[model samples]
Target: MYRTWMRFLTPGPAHHRLGLVCLGVGLQHGALPTVGPRTLDHHVAVVISAGTGWYATPDGRRTPVTAPALLWLTPGVPHHYAPDPETGWDEAFVDFTGPATAPYTELGYIEPDRPVVPLTEAAAPRGVVARIARAARRDNPLLEVETAAAVHELLVTLRRARADLAPDGDPVLKALAHDACTPMTVADHAAKHGMTPAELRTAVRRGAGCSPKDYLLGIRLGRAKELLATTELPVAAVARRVGYDDPAYFSRLFTRRTGMPPVRFRAQQARAVPGGYGDRVPDPDDPPMIAGPRRP
Candidate 1:
């Protein structure tokens, strides 16, 4: 006989504004009946952890669903599926929806076009689902907020677990981020990697959901901010360290992006140190222990 446990939630409007909210969660196993040939109004991440199944898209093409796979059922999408009648499948699912989903989709964290996704492992995402299920208690006052926060974690975990992605991330994206502080044009960076500028653009867009130039600038400006706030370096020194040779140009760029000049931003964001600022972190609360003489 099949066994199933599930909880459906109705979070208030205020929780919806928190950017992501959980609608439901479930865990099931054994010979389950067929699901849908129907449509849903929200999204469901059905994680198949064991056994096998078959899924059909709106176009009527069916794909096999093996263990360690995910089925992304998005809003207004027609979906149909079922486990093998004899073996059945172990499945856990999380239903979620929010404005945050749009950006998550754009950033490649969610794939609507490809409904069935192979995962390298199902344990991590399943753990997140279990947490959501635990938080689904009827009388938990913090249930809505706790489960909603876990939804965000669940999405990120699923993205990282995709079978297509490398364990460390895309090689090209990793290399680009590694060299982000170098003073090189996108074309120069592309040439170094043996790619054309157009190809580099496509890779960055696919991996990061942004142009290559924007990606490098984000990294460079972030370093510039850190140097300005933590060190007593002059603006020009900060600029040079972050790859901009022309101080005037760096100032303008930084101000345009950060809405203030470097000095002003530093003034506002600088950390307060009990002792004078230095490379070593301040340990005001926990002083280093002194050694006592050893007993003879």
Candidate 2:
């Protein structure tokens, strides 16, 4: 006997601008039936939390799947799979597609070439699925955006849970982020870590899905933005804090990357405390209001 709970969604065009939209979600267990010897037009992440199954390609090659695994049924990929007849399986799946899928796939978060992924554990991804399911209720006005947000979280959670990643996460990426404000060149950073520049680039690409220089630049710029938006520091001081010695170069790079000069960005985004600024930026989604000084 098999049991299933599923919801299919059709979000409007405007919601697609959010960059990721959900098409469907499902949670199932028991002796499930075989899936396609066919192809799909969109992507599906079928997460198996329990039991065992076998996945096959159109070429008839089969890959065995145990508990805590993910099946990436990507667009136009011929796929076939089913659970053991007697034991069945417990599974959750999210079907999503949008322009953002291209970049995500390119970034190594969604692997088309490696369809069957072993997961260290499915709990984190399953929790995101449960959130999506809750948002799936009929006539829930926020359904589209809510589920879409959860899909992004789902992708990130799945990436982190990949069996290949160390349980504590990528040490090199962590170290690089820690030292991002030290004004080191990529080669210099590589030497500090006892690696050649080429080897460091490869490691960062594998762990973070970007070149080392790009990764460090992202960290430095993020910190610079936080300082600009929360403090009264001069642009030159902010630049120096984020590893750039030249204020002119920093302003030009910031403008090119963010489409605004630092002063303009500060004017628009500043959330100053009366007497202090925190090191971290608050989440824009639920930022605390900073009350200015009382009127005399």
Best by lDDT: 2
Q: The CA-based lDDT of model 1 is what?
A: 0.91
The whole-model C-alpha lDDT of candidate 2 against the native structure comes to: 0.93
TM-score of 1: 0.90
lDDT of 2 by residue, 30-101 (tens): 999999898999999999999998999789999999989999999998999999989999999999999999
N/CA/C clash count, model 1: 0
Q: 1-296, model 1: which lDDT tens digit per residue?
A: 79999999999999999999999999999989999899988889999999998999888898999989999999999999999999999999999999999999988888899899999999999999999999999999999999999999999899888998875678998998888887889999999999999999988887777899999999899888877777778899889988889999999999999899999998998864444344455499976444688999
**Candidate 1: residue 130 lDDT (0-100):** 95
In order, how many clashes per candidate? 0, 0
Number of clashing residue pairs, candidate 2:
0
Compared to the true structure, candidate 2 yields what TM-score? 0.89
Can you list the residue pairs that collide in candidate 2?
none
Please give the distance, in angstroms, between residue 260's alpha carbon in candidate 2 and its true position after superposition: 1.4
